[model samples]
Target: MSIDLSIDLPGLHLKNPIMPASGCFGFGREYSAFYHLDQLGAIMMKAATGTERFGNPTPRVAETASGMLNAIGLQNPGVDKIIAEEVPFLAKYDTCIIANIAGSTIEEYETVAAAFNQTSDVHALELNISCPNVKEGGIQFGTDPDMAAEVTARVKAASNHPVYVKLSPNVSDIVAMAKAVEKAGADGLTMINTLTGMQIHLPSRKPLLANRTGGLSGAAIKPVAIRMIYEVSQHVSIPIIGMGGICNAEDVLEFLLAGASAVAVGTANFQNPFVCPEIIEALPNVLAQYGFSSVQDAIGKGVSVYE
Candidate 1:
């Protein structure tokens, strides 16, 4: 089943369907040193906050069964610094740059989006609402459908740039929240943000993360991500960026087959900074094996339906 990997993420066009998830890829200059940035479909930059954040303590990350727990606290150098520094460096890269923006308050989200809207380099803006690793309010915006829509509506109105609300998998019913955002005018969606979890030290009996609960990501959360993708895809017409445990070409195929128009390599990058390019190169072979012609032809093929 040869598949067509060419996909149009609404307003953004891409040569392939694979992207390097934010945070995990840094500013992309290092990744570019290893491979041509043009080789990637898109680059979702690390989640940037309205104000510069120093992040969390040293023991911020803990390893889970098939996943990893993180309490990075949205450590970013602030929107102004990012636009002044990272944005300029990112513009040099050939791939599309989707700035993942976060804020401690609703007004901050609007401010960040409005600030980025005047820029010419960014292809899209990914709202970081599901940042479960934070201490204050990032996750609060995503846990409730109303707050999710409120944030999306504010950001959407603030910026004309393509808006993609990254949905958190920690919610009780992501479908309702996704539907709310979509109805409130979100340009697109990125399903299955890290799941909230915690780990305890054996002898100390204390939480591994100083913040206690953190978001869980990596290979362990792939199933949960796919499930969210399946449910959200069924309810929304906008494109979906499926990510979580995606590691290789096979995982890419699973996401598309499950209904994701594109896939982002998150924690997998820590293990293989070369994963994005590898997936792009391996996709053709995987398509051949599946008898699909393009990535679009493969989406939603495996979703179960009693109807």
Candidate 2:
């Protein structure tokens, strides 16, 4: 029995609900060696900036108990390179391409969004307002509702395709942020970017990561991601792409049940290059086990059942 795993996001018709999180999957070229790129739902390319970025210094990544911290600083070759080189490379595949854009200012975000507006290769745009590793932009626009709405509105107005605002978990009221972006006219949402954390090298008496504080991701944050998705889903009407420590079919199911229209696999992609396809392959059986006939049938299943 073929369980229909396809999901219809705001402007994306995903073949399946499994794909790599931005920054985890490096533009989809490297992972092509592991599996066919078209086997998954969509590819969220690395965060693009108005100008090229060298990213953070050495020691940008460190391991923790159940996760890892990263301060990669949204390193990329800029929007021009992404559109000229990477977009065409990904267009070769039969997969949907979602470009993740980061900026230090609203103008930068608008510039990148408007640039993508001229392209037909990109199916959607994910506004990276939740990246904790960056200094100027990223979480700065995400923490406050007004700033988050401003960035969302700007990018939404500039982009022709759908705009999904990636939200930060570092905020005190995540639902408020979600509602703010929704009011700002975000087409969809990707909840719970990495939580802010730090690690110290006890022996050297210095910070483990060069940036001192970095975003934390892995199994440790799955609960937080689910809770935020659940909470935000209760308030917003737009579709959600829930992510944060999703490594297996069960985790994906949890996200769907919590009201995510789709989900992105992040840290797991780093551990196993074949993880996305593996999850996509395993989803049918998992859905059948829960008595669901289609992936969409499971979305928000537990939202009303619980609490």
Candidate 3:
């Protein structure tokens, strides 16, 4: 049977549910050589700030058991550069474009969103409110319901495209944060950003990363991501773009069943630049095994039964 994998968010329509996490996928140029960039649902560009960022100091990344820690600190070429250079490059492809914007303050967030507001190339905005690696604006806005809502409202007001609030997994209550953003008029939600973690070096007798702590990702956090997506989906009405440790087609299906309208691949990109296409190619057979004819039919299947 032919399987239809199309998924629709507020103002966005994806041919499939697989896309790269913001920082992992670099403006669609590097990965375009591996496969047709338009084959995937969308391209979530690197997080852009109001101004260019040098990012964190050296040794900002460390490897752990089944995952990796990164303190890259939202390093980007800034919003203007993205609009002038990156967006046009990506617009050459057939895939939708989702800009992930970050800032050190509320006004910065507004500025970045407003800049994108004038662009027709961008299909949506994924607010990076949950970046733990950043010191100023990321996790701070995501961890607090009030601040999360405030940022959502501000960005929503400034954005002409749909705004998706990416929530932090470090919070005490993921559902509460999801609800807050929804109430603040978020068009969609991206659940469970990387968890905060630290690694120690045996010889140096110090932290492995220069920043001391970093956001942990990969297979290590898949279970947490699933749980948070399940919980948040139950509490909120907006569409969810679930991401965390998604490496294969099975993992993507699991996220969809857990109530995610879409899923994103992160560290997997570093290991296999072809992973996204691999997963997309395998999706049809997997859906057949589960007796699913279309991707939309499986979304929130588990949640509906549990509730």
Q: Which residue runs does candidate 1 get wrong by more than 4 Å?
A: 1-3, 304-307
For 103-125, candidate 1 gives per-residue lDDT tens digits of 88999999999889777899999
For every model shown, what is its TM-score relative to the native structure?
Answer: 0.96, 0.99, 0.98
What are the root-mean-square deviations of the candidates from the true structure over C-alphas? 1.5, 0.8, 0.9
Ranking of all predicted structures according to TM-score, beginning with the best and ending with the worst: 2, 3, 1
lDDT per residue (tens digit) for residues 57-109 in model 2: 97989999989999999889999999999999999999899999999999999
Q: By TM-score, how accurate is candidate 2?
A: 0.99
**Candidate 3, 109: how far from true, in Å?**
0.1
For model 2, the stretches where C-alpha displacement exceeds 4 angstroms are: none
Worst 10 residues of 3 by lDDT: 298-307
Model 2 residue 227 lDDT score: 91
Q: Give the range where candidate 1 is weakest over 10 consecutive residues by summed lDDT.
A: 298-307
Residue pairs with clashing backbones, model 2: none
